[model samples]
Target chain A: MNFDFGFAIVAAVIVVSALFVVRAANLIHAVLWLGVTLLGTAALYAQLNAPFLAGVQVLTYVGGVVTLMIFGVMVTRRHDGIDVVAQTEGADRGFIFASALFVVLALVTWKSAPHVPNPAPVASSADIARALLGEYLIGFEVLSLLLLAAIVGAVVLVRRRDPEPAGEPSPAAAAVSEVNP
Target chain B: MNEFLQGGLYGGGIIVAIMSSLLFVLWTERKMAARMQSRIGPTFTDPLGFLQAPADVLKLLQKEDIIPEKADRALFNNAPLLGATVAIAGAAVVPFSATIVGADLEVGVLYLLAVGALGVLPVFAAGWGSNNKFALLGAMRAIAQSVSYEVPLVLAALVPVILAGSMKLSDIVAYQSSHHWLVVWPFFLGIPAFGLFMLAMLAESNRIPFDIPEAESELVAGITTEYTGMKFGLFYMAEYLHTVIASAVASALFLGGYDGPIAPGLWWMVLKTGLLVVAIYWLRWSLLRFRSDQLMALCWRWLVPSGVVLVVGAAVWVVFAG
Candidate 1:
């Protein structure tokens, strides 16, 4: 309820992790850091009154999407080659200006931020259920339908189009079998 | 009694209880494993292996904490802590009884499911940090299994949620106590829902049969292949904790948690959970490891459909009953 130092530290970690995700050089590193950012956000959401949404965010966004994106990047690239695509060319003056601006914003925020009060007592899950099923039943059902559609779309999108015959396994599979045997 | 649980002190106490439960469950699990193998299990220390967990903890603490010379020492060191911490955070919402729980938050069920779901990150972190081929493969397998099973687990869980008309664990428990256990009234449907829930929990925890991620014969402990001493111990603890929590959840949802004529509240809850744990272990030993493809197909094809049917059936039943 009262602002615990622990929660503040966690908040800082989450914020810093988000910054790292943006600044990290490697795509893999960025994705991993993004996981940290997502987790931090989920924690923050938990601290708020939205544990369900937080769970959904972490499960779907962090757990599902981020993993898929990382796998996609890895599978698409040359596994051995490290291509450091230079996103920010020499912009030292701009970077310094942006840093100064960020510092000012941080100082202003720190100075003016009101003391956060104790956490309010949250509604029980029953309240949420009553609202969803009683009033928002159609919306809930529609959401379910959308989820089904999304799963179908994902299956269609990721389907192996070539239809490779079962008799001829991929070279990697063959090599794996040889080694295992 | 519920008012006391709503207070801060009891909240903290519940945290301590869950943590101790995690430790005690591990000792029990080891003893069980030893018994199954016909070997003496930590009997020399505590007469009945009661203090075995504490002794094991002390041993782990005393072991030389070594970082691999080539490892990303920071990530490698932190990974176990992350795993353990996330696993602990999951306990906050698990309703042990009518009045015994931590943080009866609005999103209780979802919070438990989500936070528990994040166990994959630490698995990946450990795999990637160690930079071992086996750990990587194990980590990948874990992630795949997690994805495969997650759908069914959530879907099956939704049946109770739909029936209870709440995602709160407390509400679900209360609903069960007031009505019969969902298992009793809807007798046949309960089998599929509980079956799907238990199977998914197994895959989620990376336990036997569903434990290809750490398949000893194939992957040499999978994602945790390279971990040693306490770092390894933490992952082990998280796993046991996951198992205990999964069993608690399954029983809580389907088997009428803390509900019986003879036993006290917590005792009733623990007894139900223990029975579920044994059943899970029995299942693990009886079934062989499913091939990853078969595992995926089983979840996607069989469990998911069953889960959907469960939710729809429950929803219909709830409407009519109301």
Candidate 2:
């Protein structure tokens, strides 16, 4: 567990999947690549001893967000050729420039940060639960309330219109969201 | 190196055990479903068709692997394998008894939920790759069902974790062996949580009553529409395997796993898991399937709220009583 073999492999997976996410032409494939990237990130979190964080990463990003993204893609009139960003001219120059900028940012942050690749695994689940429930209880509850507000707002904003006057094919596309029940 | 090899071998053994048990699960479902429907089921494969599932699996696998001409090659070829792989991987954290486990992860409960969530990806991938509209629709249904049900499922699972005060499956079991089973203790908290867990389990595994994702009449086998041969077989196996693994988790979380009298701990664990598996099949046969709309409504309107209340109640109970 202390060795870098696992870290290197997981990092490679994350980088490759993220690259594919950017380069994939098909919308669904891109979403799937995003999922793979999220999973790889979760693996890295586990290696860093943030097992709880890793689990939630997979549960929320790969599981919830990505699934919704997939449904969003599928419910659209078309699933393919949705990703044209990678196909347009001048994209390579932009990508290369972005990569270079990202490398520089990584180097700058690496120099300043405390390097604790093998921290003593102090951030266990119990410690987190205690701190959140005891010291930060108010903050946690408030954040939860904020999330609930967001949900309510979204539902209200997108409240379904009354049934289209008879004989119309119906906006069953809206119901396609029911795909994700 | 030696410890690694031993661990690998032990994990391999668990997988083999799970695989073999699938046959028994299949047999029981057949006999049970038949009895429920008042019709005869397979009675010939291996002395009352005991090995009929494996036989059917063999037949399905031997058929020619058919890749649709327009299918996305990479995803179409690999998604079912991924589905089956995820199901087996989730089992790694499940303590079959006091001693047997592939990896007793400290955060085992969360890991199981994560892997369970990962199950949605493969179905969507398969659907997208198939280039078939109905497959897309079915995959969409699966994603929706899993994602929706996952909310209540996680909250319900957390009730046990909250009661035991640990996310480790073995610790949860130990807690139950010493105290009461979480499903029985905490006064009125356990039953609702367990009920919610059972419902979510049915939906998560796409079992009957929640099988709208593969409603045969509607979507032509849903996500497996374009699959043939072993690939199709793999998807079906994954469904059964998901339920089996989920049952193991449920037994560990709710039943007093391995706590029965006059038997080795492993045997009791196996017995409880077997019963839970059969009970799930009974549930599937006894109920009618949910239409996709009703499915969502049931989840959002009933199960999720119940789960939240149960979780809060369990947490409060753990603090005051336990």
Candidate 3:
């Protein structure tokens, strides 16, 4: 399949699902829509001849991130159907940020490389791996370090604040109980 | 037919074959589990209980379909179907033999991994949509277990991918057929990686010792507490189908799929998959369920670390030995 037609179809699916993601009233539905959006983006990556990115997109986003998001949503809230998801009007900000980030990424990838803005017709995972580790090793390592820092930060944020008095539940646990109850 | 239609037909064919095979597997599982406890299993339903699975399925079909008054209708009705769909979809990348197969994508191994891991979502949806406390609790445990186990599962599967130097299942099998099954070769790395993969596969499939998500004693029917009739049947069938396809994928990766002396390729593939399926059931019947905390501890404290080590070992073996 040539690029444009596949990209268009996949992009359309991604955009529609992403719209549902932002507009769904139920939190769970929103999360599921996000999964569809990610799966579509993975298809787009496949269409773009970046099969490695497509696999990682499906594996990491659909399998890992989406599951994590659902767990967090389920455990922390009464989100089955009783509570409608929150809404915000910062969608314009999101659009601006996404577009700006896209432009920056496009420039970084296109401007620095051999001036071929057109991606190759086919690139296997091994080719991508060699490039990432050979020419872009520093960038990959730094990104991993950044991910490590974020993970540590999350652990710290969720750590117990202090010891509770005997038989007294921690406030965080208490809040969870109240919400779930 | 167009490619889309052909793909659909192929996928539908695989699903039908797998689901029908589940009848045999279901009987085998019950009889095996019963025999392990020294009891007769399902013999009265038919001769040797061969017809029992189909009879039960028919009974389920005749029962009333139910959606709780408080439940989300769409998700409640569709989650089980989604579960079954994900289970069947993984079959697309499974190379059953040298010739007969599904789409042999370049990234077939990753395709299987992604699809296998996608099984967790339906449980979450079913649990939340049921609007029952038991169901919600089940979904919570499921997500936690699936997420934790999938890390090690993916890492361990990647060991074979590294050793074979490709993500394509066909290539991996070809590599194995030409050299050695991954379960035997590479001296130290292959066996351990295969073992770790099996453990994580059990958790991923929510088989015994890792089936806390559906622990019968505490959670009633767990995620399926609110499901009934054919909807529940779909979930039941999807689960067995998942294990069967998982065994197929495992054999394709580690057991020299479709490659053996004298026998036809399909027979070899089927034989290996059958043995693995029986092995999985054996473990289920032989062991007790694990505590929730113990499951988590097993994944994070041991399996994940071993998975990382195995991946590195495979890669290093490739670098020095390949």
**Each model's TM-score, in the order given?**
0.82, 0.90, 0.87
DockQ of each: 0.50, 0.78, 0.55
For model 2, how does the per-residue alpha-carbon lDDT over B1-322 read when each residue is reduced to its tens digit? 6998999899999999999988888888898899889977897875687878878878996898888898999999999999999988898999887889899999999999889888887887898889998998888788788888999999999898888889999999999888888666764777778778988988987888899988899898888988888898888889889888888888888887777646648888888888888888888888877778889989999999989888888868878877
Q: In model 3, where do residues sit more than 4 Å from their true spots?
A: A1-9, A75-84, A88-120, A160-181
Q: What is candidate 2's fraction of native contacts?
A: 0.91
Query: Of the pair 1 and 2, which is ahead by TM-score?
Result: 2
lDDT (Cα) of model 1: 0.78
- Of the two candidates 1 and 3, the one with more favorable lDDT, higher being better, is 3
Candidate 1 has which clashing residue pairs, if any? Answer: none
**Model 1 agreement with the true structure over B159-215: per-residue lDDT tens digits:** 888877777777788787888787887776677788888888888878888888887
Best by DockQ: 2
- The candidate, 2 or 3, that scores higher on lDDT is 3
What TM-score describes the B chain of model 3? Answer: 0.97
Candidate 1 lDDT for residue A1: 50
- For residues A113-146, what per-residue lDDT tens digits would candidate 1 score against the true structure? 6664446457555666679989999999999999
Model 2 Cα shift for residue A57 (angstroms): 0.8
Q: In model 2, where do residues sit more than 4 Å from their true spots?
A: A1-3, A76-89, A113-117, A163-181
- Give Cα distance to truth, residue B30, candidate 1, Å: 3.8
lDDT, candidate 3, A1-181, per-residue tens: 4657777788899889998998887777889999999999888888777877888898899988898888677656655556545576788898899899999999898777786556766877788889999999999999999999999999999989874678987677679679997
Candidate numbers sorted by TM-score from highest down? 2, 3, 1
